[model samples]
Target: MTTYICDDPVDRRAGLDAATAAAARGELVVMPTDTVYGIGADAFNSAAVRALLAAKGRGPDMPVPVLVGSWNTIDGLVVSVPPVARKLIEAFWPGGLSLVVEHAPSLSWDLGDAKGTVMLRMPLHPVALDLLRAVGPMAVSSANRSGQPPALTSSDATAQLGDQVSVYLDGGTAPIGIASTVLDVTGPVPRVLRQGAVALDALREVAGEVIGAGQPDGA
Candidate 1:
């Protein structure tokens, strides 16, 4: 178990290298994101993903989300990007917005109980972006035990996760210190599954008429 202080350029580069190597080995890593710290694994590694779930004491019923380095990464993951999804991505990607879309049937990895859909996001943190760009898509979830408040700092993550995570990239406290707004885009209209950093009003501005999960379609 290693924790790298990433405020130093030298330490940051080294931490990224260690994290990339760890993911390649199918090991779990804790890294910073725009909203909070996340524990991540190589998205293609089922065993690693399972380990990530175990580390958090979470069940498959709550599937992990995937974090991408770029906007274009989502094209290959989902069956097809809806026009509204593109609009949302254009407006709030690299920030705090997660879209749940139907993943391509041909893909091999498993995130558990997601049914046929996957939640994807592109975080706006430099350390996270650099690591994701190097490691490809990662199965990431909030870095804390299930039902606990999300970790806003690497130390908070470490306190909960301990040696379960192979690499801990301490990128200081999370900038937003809140969870991302999660939206399900598989429906005819975008629906807000969980509201967080991004407001529903802002989502409406970009996609027009967004609905909460409780509301009926077209409401």
Candidate 2:
């Protein structure tokens, strides 16, 4: 396994190229995003997604969220993005705020226990955006073992994933140290599964019924 330092321009460009190629081959890459370091694989490759789960010591019951390059890509993956969801996307996307929407039934990709829904986000980091654009959609999760704190830097991610990953792109420390706020738009209520970067008030402005804090499950 090779670890590329993303400090220099030449090295950053080279690392992006190598990482993109590695992902296309269904191999894992540890790279930085706006919020945290992520371990990612080609979303369309079921075997690759399974490998990612193994690397994290995670079970098949937990679904990994996806990272996309644009809004059109978002529409392509989900069965439908309701107007309220679209409003949330417009307000906080390219930043945080992940939306759990109904997955398109015709698509053949398997992302663990997503069932009929998938969590999707478009990060604001340049390295993440570049990778997503080059490799299409990716099934990405916090680059750490299950139950561990999210990795803030690529080095932190590498320490956990180790040689299991093909390449580690060191893009320095992440901008946001928390996970994205996850909103479930698939259920009857638009609810916050996990809250971190985006607040519930912002979500409530667009969504008629935004359930979060004070709720039994999460916020």
Candidate 3:
């Protein structure tokens, strides 16, 4: 496995080239995100996405999230983005917030039991965004085994995933303290699934009355 410590003025082109090349070949690439390091593979490649799940010791029951470079990328994958969702996306995207929305019927990609929904995030990290723009959407999950604590750095991820990954793009320490907050935006009202970096109070302020984590939509 090859590792690139991108902390000290690394070349953006080099990082993007290496990451996109590896991802295109159905290989795993570990890279830093706004919250934590993520293990990434082409979202549209089932084999690559399956391989990513295998390396992380993940099963097909839990769906993996996709990270995009911009709002248009999300629009392509999902059938619709509600007006409320649009407000949240406008305010918190390119930051830590993952929205679960109904996938476009025409799409054929599989990432575990995505069912009819897809989790979408647009990270604020530069390296991750560069890779996403160059490689397109990626099936990105926290770079650790399914139940393990998320990796904060490339080294931490390497220690866990090892050579199962083809490349590692190290961008020093992570800036965010927690993973992106996950919310289900597939229904009439947005509902919180997991509260993390983007806290509930902040979400409530921006989104008005969002359903709390682990509770019924109107609870």
Candidate 4:
């Protein structure tokens, strides 16, 4: 396992290079993100993705999200961005927000049984962006066992992932010690699957009439 401690966020070239090499070789990497530390693998690399899932004890049915450097990268993976989805991207991108959309038929990479859908996000942290930009697209999930609490720092991630991941980029603790708010934009109406740092009202401001994943019988 190769580990690099980045003294300065801006001077993470070595760590970025190591991460890039590991991803190219279809190996998992533990890296810091704005919301939390994540276990990442090349989204296009089936072997790496599978290894990541196995390491995290994640189910095959549970699709992993892809991390990108910017919103422009979304078009390459997703077929089309809904208006509301676009609004949310503009409002909360570079922050904790993950949008599920229809995957492009042109994409050959399989993150899981996504069923023609893919979850994509642009992380707000510099270290996350740097890693994403260096590695292109990576299938990332919270760095921990599937049923365990998400890792908020590199130490937490290392403790859970250990040597399973090829590289660990230590960028300190995450600003938001929670997962990104996951929203499904595949259907006509945008719905919140899980609310985290971003609130429902805030999402509604950009995506009018946003609905929760489930509702009470009476209400």
The TM-score leader among the candidates is 1
Question: What are the runs in model 1 whose C-alpha is more than 4 Å off?
Answer: none
Q: Quantify all predictions' global Cα lDDT against the true fold.
A: 0.95, 0.89, 0.88, 0.87
Give stretches of model 3 more than 4 Å off.
Answer: 10-12
Off by over 4 Å in 4: 9-11, 216-219
The candidate maximizing lDDT is 1
lDDT of 1 by residue, 1-219 (tens): 999999999999999999999999999999999899999999999999999999999889999999999999999999999999999999999899999999999999999999999999999999999999999999999999998989999999999999999999999999999999999988788999999999999999999989975788788
Which of candidates 1 and 2 is the stronger one according to lDDT?
Answer: 1
C-alpha positional error of residue 112 in candidate 4 after TM-score superposition, expressed in Å: 1.2
- The residue-by-residue lDDT of candidate 2 on 29-51, one tens digit each, is 98888888999999999999999
TM-score of each: 0.98, 0.95, 0.96, 0.95
By TM-score, the better pick of 2 and 3 is 3
lDDT of 2 at 119: 91
Provide the clashing-pair count of each candidate structure. 0, 0, 0, 1
Q: Write one digit per residue (lDDT tens) for candidate 3, span 76-98.
A: 88788778888889999899999
All candidates: CA RMSD in angstroms?
A: 0.8, 1.9, 1.3, 1.8
> Whole-model lDDT, candidate 2?
0.89
Question: Clashing residue pairs in candidate 3, if any?
Answer: none
Model 4, span 99-205: residue lDDT tens: 99999999878788889998888999887798898889889999999899899888888888899999888888888999999998887778888888788889888
